[model samples]
Target: MTIPLVRVHGVDDVRLDNIDKPRTAPGDVLIEVLLCGICGSDLGYIGMGGLGMTHPMPLGHELVGSVAEVGERVSHLQIGDRVVVNPMAGGNSIGNGGTEGAFSPYLLVRNVAADERAVIKIPDGLSVDQAAMVEPLSVALHGCRQGNAKAGDKVVIFGAGPIGLCVALCLNYLGVERLVIVDQSSHRLAAAESIGAVPFKAGSNNLGEFLIQQHGQSELMGMPVPSSDIYIEATGAKPVFEQIMNTAKTGARVVVLGLHKQSVPLDLANVLLRELNIVGSMAYSDEFPAVIEMLTGGKIDLQPIISHRFPLSQFSEAIAQASEPDEAIKVLIDCQC
Candidate 1:
């Protein structure tokens, strides 16, 4: 019983391979993967060699699937139940080098009864594709939470990628009316605009002037600056962080969600002078259920951010499409296809 999966072998190398199917244990639950999203971190891993493992490591964490086999000891879940998995669960690390990832026909959820956050049943009426988006949306929601984003705060996001767009959706759902998204792609900007976020092209105009016009203006050291209350740095580009630090008004909170592979020089002096609150957001914590509730209640629509879809067999093509920020926003892989 062999199953096909995607893994990273070495630098600039990622491909599908066949491995022995996992056997279900008494405390484990098996899931037949329905959909998995290609994350930017997956691409970063490919470019930077691998997932820092001696052997080929499985890749992909943003996923949702149906329960295929429930172990005898697992009473909370039943076969055929649709669920979203928390990859960071202790003793059941999926898609992050602990166990087999979701980019396959089946995934074994170990220690089902031990951790409550391990597997969550997807509520009725949520589409399968949208359910697959829960993981990333949780990440976006965590970023917003780290920034302590609240209602009536003027927010500016420095990227229009999946996380950036999802952050906009989360902020909007939280009753934040004024939101602006900056990106280099018109297509992604259009997607952001479709989600009720004001879109500004990254390099086409002066972002500081535009931000002042949209969010209002304030003075830092007697110099005019954008008065946005919150600034989320979702773009991993070094210059984007510098730009945010340069223009963030006094008392503004900046949430760093992007993964910066190389070291980024920060202006500590400006940060101190302006009294900026710069915080970093890791994966997620206690955000899955909240995001799911928002989805269940129709608080936000993730459908607009879904830019492309491909079958598991076409995984390479999907990776290529996902790498192009100008062409795609969120690329999903249909594992059950």
Candidate 2:
């Protein structure tokens, strides 16, 4: 039997092709993909023709699925069990280089048995669609954890994209005193506001002035400029970088979550003068189960952020929608639909 899958051949080249169904090895397991999200990095890979990827890469990491066939040696997972995959653990991370991604009808989990480290069983009452979000939520949770966000601290997140909104939601759940999100798009900023974040239009109001008006004078700057306890950069834009450096308060924790495509000059003097602590967050590390608990317990709501959905066959349209910040927030592909 042939399975249909999405493959990227080169820059701006994505195709739905039929390939042979993968055979489950003695210790392997096969999963039927239910839903997969189009991430910002996925768009980067598609646009650059596998920019940082191996050729003919299958591109999907945020995925949820069910066990179709458990290999002879596998003991933990049973057939028909719903699961949210942690693609980072196993060497064969679906959609990355080591293994084929969930873009296909089926995925082969090589050698790793179903466990908390590799996969987390979706709790009762959580829909598969909601489960598909665990991966990105974990990413956001990790960033918040890195920033050491605490109760009563003011947080200013630059960018209202999916990651930024997720970070905002996480911070809100953590009991931050003030949560503000800045973005150029009113559409995207509206999504941020829906989750209780104060949204600011970047171009309309001067960020520093707006912050100062909303909050108060920066202790370090001693001027009418906003200074936040925590500053998160999620836009990956050069100007936002400068804004963060200029507006951050002394001793502020700056967490960078966006993947900047180009290099930007850093203001080392500002860092030295203010004694700012800057940190970079990557994918995630051991934060999945906490995110799941937050979702199941109703501490965080991700439903509002999912702006659009497309069938697996319409992946191109999904990508296009995800690419437009004005059109969508979190675009998902219904693999089984």
Candidate 3:
């Protein structure tokens, strides 16, 4: 049987194509996709052609679904179980150049095991939309953990996009009282304000002075600097990174969560002089359950972060919506629709 699935044929080329539904193996589980969220990386993938694959690559990783079929060897999962998958783990990665992607009517998760925990069951009372958010939220949580965020710390996040906003949510949940979000878009800045973050327009004024105003000032190499404890780089813009390095306080930790296509020049002398710790956060690591718990406990409200939803049939429209960073954040594709 064939089903509608989204595939990236080449650069600036993606389409809804009818593809054969994957057959479940002995250790595999079949999932009927419910929703999938578009990532900023998806646009990058579209621009750079497929994920360096010879064949058309499947797109989408942040997804939630119901278990349509369970393999005989899959003891942990059962048919009809509502779940979210960790695409980075196991051989059954949906999307990321995998044979099957979440932007389809169904997905095949391979190699289920007791220890892997690749497929996580969503507890009752968590809506499918909330469940779909696990992947990206996990990414945000991982970013926070990388920054070693703590209570009472003043944090500044660059980029008020989905990940940045989610990072703000995570920081708040972790009890970081003073939080500021910087973005170029007024629309997204307003969204940041809605979630209790101080919205600082990207180029409105000197970021160093603004940070000092919000987080107080400290001396770095005998010069005044913003006393923010942590800075999260989520915009992937070279200038933002440069700004962070130039203005960050001594002993500050900079967590980079965004994908930078080109290598940006680094000032090693400044990093050494300021004693700054720069770390990179990729995908996620064991943060899914924490994000799920926060969502289940209602500690974070994801509704405001979500800006658009499109049905699977209208994936192109969804992609177009997501491409406009000024207007959209956390655009989701309803697979079941």
RMSD of each: 1.2, 1.7, 1.1
User: For each candidate, how many residue pairs have backbone atoms clashing (under 3 Å)?
Assistant: 0, 3, 0
Alpha-carbon runs more than 4 Å astray in model 3: none
Clashing residue pairs, backbone N/CA/C < 3 A, model 1:
none
Tens digits of per-residue lDDT for model 1, 1-337: 8989899899989989999999999888889999999988888878876768898888888989999998888888988899999998746668777657889989888888777578889988888877988999999999999999999999999999999999999999999999999998999999999999999998899999999999999999899999999999998889999999899999999999998767999778998999999999998989999999889897777778998999999999999999998899899999977
- State which candidate has the highest lDDT: 1
lDDT of all the models against the reference? 0.90, 0.83, 0.89
Clashes of 1: 0
Q: What TM-score does structure 1 among the candidates reach?
A: 0.97
Q: State how far residue 16 of model 1 sits from its true place (Å).
A: 1.1
Q: Write the per-residue lDDT of candidate 3 for residues 92-204, one digit (tens) a residue.
A: 55678777788998988887764347788989989988988899889999999998999999999999999999999999999998999999999999999998999999778
- Shift of residue 33 alpha carbon in model 3, Å: 0.6
Clashing residue pairs, backbone N/CA/C < 3 A, model 2: 10-49, 11-49, 95-101
True-structure RMSD for candidate 3: 1.1
Q: Which residue ranges in model 2 land beyond 4 Å of their true spot?
A: 51-54, 114-116, 221-224
What does candidate 2's lDDT look like per residue over 1-337, in tens digits? Answer: 9988888888899888888999988677788999998888788878888745555888788888898988887777888888888887766666765558787778877766644367567877788778888999899989999999999888899989889998998898889858889998889988888889999998886777777776676777565446578899998888788878887878889998998888978879989988889999998989998988888886677877999999998988888889898879999898875
